[model samples]
Target: MDGNATIGHGPDRHPAAWNPARTREEKEEQGRRKEERSPMPPVTIMELLEKCKEKTALCDAREAAHRIKNDGDLVLIDVREPGEFEENPVPGAVNIPRGFLEFKICETCPEDHAPILLHCRTGGRAVLAAKTLAEMGYRNVAAYQGTVDELLAALE
Candidate 1:
């Protein structure tokens, strides 16, 4: 039976709007539109990192480490995946995976204007994460250019 075939139900009870299935012509039109749609340009991690470097603040690992240690107000975030973060954690950094950083950032740092720093397994992910934060209207966003291990080494 068709989705629009609601037995013993009037239009008011089971309106056409409630039908989930598309008509054959509608499905064909949708297929045509899908075929005509242009593909999205490929975006590599390196390309995203370059765009982030152009738009966001670039902080050396040593400088970021120094500021994080010396300053009390800066919010440091580790944007690596959970497994990687659990394996080796940054002492003062909060764990927010890169995928969820934008969604969870407000909860972690309520003030958009607050000083925030980001890092990941390497500089690439940090750059992208920092870019996302900056796009979200965060005032002071810094991306450390190295992994957590490298940042720690620089801090030493």
Candidate 2:
């Protein structure tokens, strides 16, 4: 079709004729306006966490501590940032930030049957991380679904 030809109807039901050679900024502005006209509904953190939890296993701090004490092969991974881990570290727990988990997990825990326990400041990141590991084909993985303080207290 020609540059001036109407392609289809836009959100306003008007014949929309977007220039094929439109600048990037012009296309971005048009997309922003369209999104503003019909914004998507928000997804809450709790909702997302619950969904992730369903797809992965969950272990409380006390259970994790007990397993660590008994199971010599269990790998406890703290999925918090370096600064947070440095400030309040969990003994015997390795620091693998959530952002780097996918890249670093294989080297840290190669055996698929090895038990993995993931934790963060809150339950959200841990569960999400667990779900990711599960999807990555880890056989035994669990997220400590509690606050860091609770985990520390239980560990002690």
* Candidate 2 similarity to native, TM-score: 0.73
Candidate 1 residues 1-156, lDDT tens each? Answer: 555654335555655444445566688899888867947656887786687799888888779889888989999999998999899888888999999998899999999889999888877888888888888999899888876788888777
Give the lowest summed-lDDT range of ten residues in model 2: 11-20
Candidate 1 Cα outliers beyond 4 Å, as residue runs: 1-41
Cα distance off (Å), candidate 2, residue 60: 1.6
lDDT of 2 at 48: 85
| lDDT of every model, 2 decimals | 0.84, 0.86
| Pairs of colliding residues, candidate 2 | none
List, residue by residue over 1-156, the lDDT tens digit for candidate 2.
Answer: 666555456754434554545667798999889889886657798888878888888888788778868889889999999999999998899999999999999999998889998999987889989888988999899888888898788877
Kindly report the root-mean-square deviation of model 1 from the true structure over all alpha carbons: 6.5
Clashing pairs in 1: none
